[model samples]
Target: MTAAIRCVLFDFDGVLADYDRDVRIGHLAHFLGRPSHAVRAAIYASGVEDAADAGLLDADAYLEALGRELDCTVPADAWVDARRAATHEKPPMLSLASKLRARGITVAMLSNNGLLMAQSWPAIVPALFPLFSGRAFCSAQLGAAKPSPAAYLRCLEALAMPPPATLFVDDNPANVAGARAAGLVGHCFAGITELQRALEEHGLA
Candidate 1:
């Protein structure tokens, strides 16, 4: 039998790329030449989480806040480049995306990425960005980040697919739970192998 799901939506950071939050903090600390704790506190004080969760901050504001905290002038593009350097490729998941597309399943990316990151995605992962035929959704544009029903709903509405007919994948438990609450079949992504197993179990592989 064919897979029950017609579309698959993915979260970018932890799912598509191995982005270590600690590493990021370290990088920020190094750039600022300050203690990690100080950098982290400044990040929290800058309302980074709230802005990200609300999807209201663009790349400029995001980077500017970090720059302000660090007492440096890190441009948005520079920050994007730094993140790209730290990110490790997840080829297996990319292969899975290709397989899904081959099966005539619609694949889309829903990422809570900064505007600069979104703009630079094509350069970072050429294969992944254009693979979906330009159906990638960035939170900076959508104004709603993951773990929010609004984000998932917007993605579903954009894809013109029902929640039941869609599969949502994310490494964050909260994001997975949010997708479930929004009525989509959600999977907490551990790795490509585990994800493939889950998809097979769900009869979507």
Candidate 2:
């Protein structure tokens, strides 16, 4: 028999909000007075972001590294501003999360992001961030990135919930597969309509 889902873990960027890489690059470029391509290369091509997400760098170290790559001082506030500018909320997804919470299902977030993202989530997704509050788990904090079963296991451990009774939702199939491998029921988020159907299967929607 299938265990009832008591908690729903959501992936932040692609699931709950839309993140525009171009917008983030542009914002950082403008703030640093560098060209957009340079900002993008420094952030993405440098592998600093992946390292940060994997807990190789803390918040201050992450910023320092980014600053070094961009050839300028990257302030925390400026980084937060760039992140906020790039994150756009998905109203339907937010509504679905709220509805799940109202139904007594615990809704939490788990994202493959750096510690700065954990710090700046309130600014990035002001309305939805508070709802996750203490339940928001990031890869930096977990010391592992999604698509790694360790990440899912660590998040489940923190939640004190058994994996069999939790539901993990992400836009990435690889991440979802990792969650499933960790023993949680995983749903690949395509759209609100499809997600609702998945939740319904779990008796959540």
Candidate 3:
């Protein structure tokens, strides 16, 4: 049964890496001279991040919108730096992905990140990504951010594989449940050790 699985889809942010929303919010608020709570409310409460992740807004458009919400013009690099501030890549998981690929399994990223992540993250950590074999897919590029069945379906279509043969891993339980609803095996990521255990449980690693 494990042999039937060919592709492993990983979620970024809380899984492959950790991000500091507080730091990001602080940076944005300081740069825009807005209140800290305002930054958080606009991004999380206002659904602006979702809109950007779903590709309703491109990087520039997203920036423009964010600026409008903050009532200031934000430098592109500032936005990038804000997001990148507390980003910590998980080397162990990356190494595991490399090992999986070496054994002929496909390891790809499915992140709910905006175009800035697609553009800036690679530039920020050019070497951290080569392990995934350049098979990275972002919500901004796909226009179907998860928790949506469309996003999972799009991934299967793009990979040219059936849902039964794919495994989706994410830190968010909601996202994991969404993947399961889409007919793919879903693993809610807790930590590197748990993820390694999960891969072995599924005979992937």
Q: What lDDT does the true structure give each of the candidates? A: 0.77, 0.91, 0.81
Top-scoring candidate (TM-score): 2
**Lowest summed lDDT over 10 consecutive residues: which window, candidate 2?**
122-131
Ten residues in sequence with the least summed lDDT for candidate 1: 75-84
Tens-digit lDDT string for candidate 2 (95-147):
89899898888889999999999888888788886678899989999999999
Q: Order of all candidates by TM-score, from best down to worst?
A: 2, 3, 1
Candidate 3, residue 203: lDDT? 77
Which residue pairs in candidate 2 have backbone atoms (N, alpha carbon, C) closer than 3 angstroms, thus clashing?
Answer: none
Task: After superposing candidate 2 on the true structure, give the runs of residues whose Cα lies further than 4 Å from its correct spot.
Answer: none
TM-scores, each model vs. reference: 0.84, 0.97, 0.90
Query: What is the C-alpha local distance difference test score of candidate 2?
Result: 0.91
User: lDDT at 169 for candidate 1?
Assistant: 93
Candidate 3 segments exceeding 4 Å error? 1-3
